[model samples]
Target chain A: MERRVKLLGTGKYLPARVVTAAELDEQLGLATGWTEKKSGVRIRHYVTTETAAQMGAIAAKRAAEAAGVSLQELDCIVCASGTAQQEIPCTAALIQEELGLSRTGIPCFDINSTCLSFVTALDVMSCAMAAGVYKRVLIVSTEIASMGLNWKQKESCVLFGDGAAAVVVGQTPEGESSRIISSAMQTYSEGAHYSEIRGGGTMVHPRHYANGHEDDFAFDMDGRKIFRLTSQLITGFVDSLLAKASVSKKQLQAVIPHQASGMALRIMRTKLGFMEQQMVDIMADHGNVIAASIPMALHEAISQKRVARGDCLLLLGTSAGLSLGGIVLEY
Target chain B: MERRVKLLGTGKYLPARVVTAAELDEQLGLATGWTEKKSGVRIRHYVTTETAAQMGAIAAKRAAEAAGVSLQELDCIVCASGTAQQEIPCTAALIQEELGLSRTGIPCFDINSTCLSFVTALDVMSCAMAAGVYKRVLIVSTEIASMGLNWKQKESCVLFGDGAAAVVVGQTPEGESSRIISSAMQTYSEGAHYSEIRGGGTMVHPRHYANGHEDDFAFDMDGRKIFRLTSQLITGFVDSLLAKASVSKKQLQAVIPHQASGMALRIMRTKLGFMEQQMVDIMADHGNVIAASIPMALHEAISQKRVARGDCLLLLGTSAGLSLGGIVLEY
Candidate 1:
């Protein structure tokens, strides 16, 4: 019943356009320093000349290089993101084409769990890998959150950035301990509307855009409700995750969590009984990249050597489904 | 090395409003019989009183009933559809809410491969089931393709309909022959743009909808190009799939395919060597239900006794990813 998939390599890509908190304050007409103080995001990247698929391909290429594997050698490509590059063909195909694997015939698809997409995909695909369905797979999380932000909602508008991250995964080598120990996810759909962009879907077609429904096209979030919901559930969720993995809090050397917010991270430290030093907090620089947050933070953690070989790591997040997800893995 | 997942039950739902080709002929200003002759569709359903999530929930309920399982008892809920009901939280969460299981805390997410989504989800989730990830899982493919149809594009416009289908799956019993024999998918991303809806995602945000980009929000298809590309690949793809399953054409008692088009179905028979009787052809009444097509046909196949216990069944399709996918299962 054990999953023996290994995290072969990781990669990340931040857009070239750096939008500082100072710039956001000027754009939103907020007082000087208000943006940084409120959002805890000093600076974040936004897409200027790049598309989500382009960012994903660059990150995928870097991941392939890090894994010492060629893009052509990957058996499958999965785009694990909340947003798609386009509405059709799935983002994975676009990324495959961008990586010049158009003719490689690599199977391409997507697994979406909104902001928890990367964690969800890793857990699901790890089973596929463990079952020998695929030998090598590339999973990418790419987001362009700026395009749909409701700028009028200052509380949520300044909390997002655009970026992409990718990982190459395969079977664990003979002596390596890399494997997914356990994963647990639960959806509280009552909070589904606590955060949403109600447009660009069948419910609100483009024909309704000019018909007094334009606001539905923008992202809207009730941060307080999300916080309240998380506070009510996260403590027990972390206990269940650690219990399922048969690992204690002390066994976790690093926590590569979704860069949800500065306040969210502090809650994990204070309420979830994790030490501050065990957490990988990148919200100050990258902001909330939505589905890209966890993997992006993971790549950063690896570069910083927060987790070493055979070390236990915890990945946790709260997504728009009102979903709480966590995975315990051995690096 | 074999996949031991079993198909427990299947269910489908078409909307209450049935649009016959004659009705379309009048609506589009074409002569009577023109629409039917061109598209080979006699009648297809279009949603009038239902949302995609609502239809999906109905299908899921029926599937659970047929499987003698309760909705609240399933381990996971996955929406395997091309079109979402909304832009955030993922469609699975919406369906979860619609099912009145908001408090059940069942994990929910989505797997998308456009028109082949159901087959892809079945293949992927089957691996998870085989790996002891979950005891029972429900996959729903619900699509309201009519909402995004480019009515101006006559050739592709008439080929779609709205519908929902679902299946409940679990581990095969020890003595049962039910199992997934093989699954094969290949993406020729060269055809990625041949069929697409350019809006609804980051690429063409809603802000650009009124700025002479209205057409970009609609579904567009170069039918001839898609036909050309599919024709160039399907024959070998079928062969590879059958070979992988170690199944021969004669061994497959049923061939459930994505009702992509009437002509596409003809190619499967004439070029791919599947007998007319072995195929489950429902395009005449349902048109193409996008991702819901295959599972809808699958449900029909079971009801009509086209596939019996211990029978071999093939699920095949060409999706917008320019992706070709097929799965051979023991029914």
Candidate 2:
């Protein structure tokens, strides 16, 4: 009953338009350097003409190329995203269409756990792939957080960017040591309301807009509460995850976190006892791209050769569900 | 690699407000009997004060009771639905809160394949359960499609209602014969645009609301195109699915199909060769509740004793991806 799953390759895509903190300062009527100091985001990408599916397809292609597999060879496509391209068809279908595999008879669907989508999908899909339910599966995490950002909430608004990342996975070959060691997810819904967009779904239908519920449509977050709730639970959660994996923090070659913020990364290095050099920090550049954060950082880690084959890697993230998700795997 | 998964229990929920086609005809100012003739719906439920999560929680509680498992014992809760309760946090977490399990630390997430969501999640989760990734899981398909219906689109508007269904699954006990035989999903995105809600996501942000894109937020479907495309592909899809399971059409004890429409159900019997008595038909009562359709029908079939233990059951549906998904299982 040994479970085996390998991370074949990873790829990421960022929108072409870059919005700098300095420019945001002018747009939001803030003083120079205030936006950067407050949000710790120097620059972040925002989509202009590109879309969530288009970015995802580019990343998927790169991942397939990196894995030495063709998109046509994929057995299934799972879109693990915080945001959707449209409401009905599921983002994965749009991505399949974008990849020109619409008629390939490949299965397409979506998994959502808000910002932790990629980590959760990787965990679940690994189980499926290892069980021989599928082979050569593609998972894409795409986000356009900027689209839902509420400029009024400068704290949360400046902390988000638009990006997409994708990973190709399959069962390990006979000689490869790559495999998922352990994964865990816990939802603390008591804090679910701490970060959310109240509209765009059934509860507060769009038709209510004529009745003056526009604010419900915008993304809102009480950042301090999320930080407080995450701080209280993450240590125990990570400890339990590592315990299940029978791996120690010292054994991990790298830590790929959700790129939540500069402050959170610093807390990981200092408060959580992880070495600064072991962490993948992209918040300053990419900001928080919601679900794309973890995989995008993983892609960066792999490309930079910071994480090598057979090395233990820790993937962790706290999402809008007030959920903590972590995966320990041999890369 | 033998896979065994058992559906321990099934439950469904509908709002107390039942609107008959007569009522709809009066509301829309249509001729008497005209609404029923076009939509093939006698009555359907619409949420008044209830939310998707509340309905799902009630169904989940019932499913747990039927399964003889406590909500606290579940390893995970997966919401498989086409509609969302909110834009973030995921509908599963919301259901967790509604069930008073917010602090239970069980993992919660969502799987969306539009109308085929329940079928897809059952297929995927069965593999996970059989693989021992999770011991017990709850999957709820809760949708409030009525909230998004565009009244102007009379053809599509009268064909949807609000409801929820849940199933509890685990690895079959040693003496039990229940297990998933085979499953398949194929997305033809060439027909993706035939049914969709173009707004409320990253593609068409709510900020565009002021500029007048209200129609984008409402559900839209070309029913004739969907029927035409489905007619061309569904026969082969079911044939391949049954073939993979090594089960013949005649061997299936019950056909639990998504109650897409009364006409679709008729076509399922007349063209797809499933006997009338073998098919579970609840479209007259529930209309098309999107992702909840298949599981809700399954609950009805199970509760009515129409499908006995160890019976061969075929679950089938066509979704917004223009995706055809089917599962053949020993119930």
Candidate 3:
């Protein structure tokens, strides 16, 4: 029998410091209506360096505890982070070590798909579980997007927050009601150029800083193009995912789209023909947490009783690389 | 019946420029015999300002042509890149656009576990195929490790090169001889401190470049610790992979260890009790290509007729995150 993978637990952590739209406007000298009307973002969280990894670790620990599993039982820990604590050895490893589960023989690594990283990790872990390679996996999506912001560029700076969310996935017998049915991922590299942090990668060569070419490392973005593409792709990907999973839109109890902007979520819900009530929109407070957005939304939805047992949930995420993906799960 | 995934074609692209051990020693002001005696590397390839996405696209095209499969037929493109071109939208998306396959409806994204990324990509593709989600998947591993190196740091700089390699994986009928049998991955987050590039990721914040922090972006390595961990993990992982595949040590045709170093490969072969001829060591010329090394070696081995049909090949790779994994496949 084909083993089904189920999401056993969910948890999220957001930084304590909340930046209001008014406070951000004063910081960046931007017009007030832009943040409220265009993005529908009123406030967002920002992480101090000390709390970023700690928040991720807390979320992961809560996920394990909620799943009735200990850190020692995790076969693998996949931390999806775009805003990492270090460039090498992956922030996942550091998170694992900090969780005091370093002696459990658990393999941990970070997956980078920008905002879509967490879903991609889910897809990878799902495949491994289905293949019987792993019985349980911890997928952590953490980001301190505020840390990477060009604080001076109000256009991009106000659109991010710091947070982490995690889910524990495990193999279960077939025919289980709460299981991941199918997942789909698509990358549009052409769109990759449309949105990005232009510096600090191999392309910019950090060593050039010695020559006074320091401005090359800040985050850059083509906002208009990303907005257009994200709107088009998320809708299409979600529909395709539902089709692939043989689930219908009416069957979905909640659609958890990545919390990029409140406006974007509204548009996606409309495109998916989902009722406003059926959508889990967390962007009003969290902004774009990148990979952590969906899990954060899911955690809120579950805690608020927006999702129930045997109800279908659709997750959609898109980010730089112009990547878009969706997962259909029964919860 | 369970479907099997088979490797239909392989291709690789190494940069045109070659840096010999002598040339490197002169550049770094190191004495002779250091590169040869310490790492057993004599030469390495490096790309000049070429993005990892471009290299991956080149290799993927070649593999697609060799497999006689049009890009439109691919269900997914999994790019294994250590030196990603961007922090968002993934390098895989860029490759998809470069190949004119972006609208082919193929899902593309980057998978990273450092050097073990390609194998992880393979395992992911294998699972998707087994789940009948994708009929054809393209797996590419590309690295521009040279870009992150501190050229003055002889120990770390001498051990990296740039290259890309790709394979076309697709579904085959049950009981096929040339199929992926089993794969395993493990990460030792505790050892993450052993090797790393200190800067350029979210941890250091690319924006920090403007603040006169140049050294934060360069690659850093704790060489001795990595060497010890790699040998032990590679040996153990490969043994477990072989056991899971139900193959005895004597039945293995060849072992493709990551091309980190010639001495490492030699030692691993001896420790694992494999004949010297059964190992594919390309580091004597390529040094370490990070994620690209194994596939580059595999391409060379196949071209040289060192691997044959129906033979059992063990693929192993380990890198930062202190991650290690291996797969047993029938050639």
Clashes of each: 0, 0, 7
Off by over 4 Å in 3: A1-3, A31-34, A151-153, A173-175, A209-216, A230-236, B1-3, B209-213, B230-235
RMSD of each: 1.0, 1.3, 2.4
Q: What TM-score does candidate 3 get on C-alpha atoms? A: 0.94
Candidate 1 matches the true fold with a TM-score of 0.99
Model 2: what is its DockQ? 0.72
For B1-331, candidate 1 gives per-residue lDDT tens digits of 4688888999999999999898888888888888788787899999997999999999999999989898978999999999988889799999999999998889999999999999889988888888788889999999999999898988788888999999999889899889999988999898899999888799988778898988888998998999898888999999988988899999999999889888889877889988899989999999999999999999999988778889999999999989999999998
Instruction: At residue A51, give the lDDT of candidate 1.
Output: 93
All models, DockQ values? 0.83, 0.72, 0.53
Over 4 Å off, model 1? none
Error of 2 at B227 (Å): 1.7
Q: TM-score per candidate, in order? A: 0.99, 0.98, 0.94
Cα lDDT of model 3 overall? 0.77
What docking grade applies to model 3?
medium
* CA lDDT of each prediction against the hidden true structure: 0.91, 0.90, 0.77
What are the candidates' interface root-mean-square deviations?
Answer: 1.0, 1.5, 3.0
